[model samples]
Target: MSKSQGYDERLAVPLRWWAQGTMLVATLWLTVVVAVPGPTAWVVTGVALALLALLLWSYGDARVVVRDGWFQAGRARIEAEYVGEVAALDAEQTRLVAGRDADARAYLLLRPYLHRAVKVEVVDPADPTPYWLVSSRHPEALADALTALPKTR
Candidate 1:
């Protein structure tokens, strides 16, 4: 949980077909080493595999799910008991970005393919923070869902 002003946000791991393709390629590359000879092949293969795993883990986990009265983000499902407020941020609206990101930050998750996102606000005296900036695929839908959730005390 990070803090700043009067909002809090939780993120999830980003998963998409492109990323899956990368994972597949990495896996295949590692498998190819089996055809190589010598101990050096094994060593190089191990290193390559390790690097690939790290890359997958890095991008495989970058999503944000917000809930009020609860805390759920990433892989862990959070109950809606510790959440505060809901916030919607998009590049088209925020204009707080560069590149093609300007018109696409209006979805559920950020992507090179689609550029939008939403975040949960954490506004408790006990948890004083500003807001979380997240990327999303369905900006309006995510915002609507978050806003529709019942407010918490």
Candidate 2:
């Protein structure tokens, strides 16, 4: 039998972001087409399409997956043994920890659109990072999974 996943999520960009980006791209296309005209108009449309594709691709890259005794956020992954002191943060606290009172050594996988977050401490003595501040729509669930990890070296 296979072990079940503890936590798995893709942190996607908010719909409003996509809407805003599309509006911006449309405006740019209009400006280019209006100013240049003819074949240049088609070039402008192609550029707009390319820009939108790139934006979506980049924004969809971040993910939080907790499985196989590992915590993966964005492009970084660490073993559960090194994880400690998971704190679920509300919008206000998330903002404070992620911004003003943030630790420089900590790893951050933050998305501006995500207001809730979880802070996971790194207990590895050799590692300079204090904790990871990660944006999560389900902070409590993520925290619970982190807390459930067995303490080990």
Candidate 3:
């Protein structure tokens, strides 16, 4: 069975268009920041640019891969052997986890802009980590795919 999740191209196309449309916005801001050049402004501008880059990468690289019996998200990949359970989580639930762990990270495949999410229990015995909380706009599909996978021993 084929299983995977990704951002809506229709939804993301506009986002990319908007990002590209606003590309020139950076140059203008940089010019203003440079012309009035101050230490604080420079720092702020630098930070803003970094944030833009991160946002772009986060959206551009957003995807979920569940093929050949594998689940891939960002830089991590898992197989059924390493997956325990797949459950849907909304904004409230996600916030709960976010509040607890300072270093917690989730590879969101759906709702880049939404507050809802999904948590998957990875069954990897090699690692102590129990599960991953991923933000997904299409939580039901994600859960279904994950739940259908055969657990690996």
Highest lDDT model number: 2
Residues 3-87, candidate 2: write the lDDT tens digits: 2558887898777778887888788888887899889877878888787878786887789988878999999999989998999
Candidate 3 per-residue C-alpha lDDT over 59-129 given as tens digits, one digit per residue, 9 for 90 to 100: 65656655556767655688777887788877777777655652344433444465766788756666666
* TM-score sort, best first: 2, 3, 1
TM-score of 1: 0.50
Give Cα distance to truth, residue 56, candidate 2, Å.
2.9
Q: What is the TM-score of each candidate against the true structure?
A: 0.50, 0.91, 0.62
- In model 1, which regions exceed 4 Å deviation? 1-39, 66-71, 75-87, 92-114
Worst 10 residues of 1 by lDDT: 1-10
Top-TM-score structure, candidate number: 2
Evaluate residue 50 in candidate 2 and report its C-alpha lDDT on the 0 to 100 scale: 87
Q: Rank the candidates by lDDT, best first.
A: 2, 3, 1
Q: What is the lDDT of residue 41 in candidate 3?
A: 62
Pairs clashing within candidate 3: 81-152, 82-123, 83-123, 111-137
The RMSD of every model to the true structure, in order and in angstroms, is 8.7, 2.4, 6.5
Whole-structure CA lDDT of model 1:
0.50
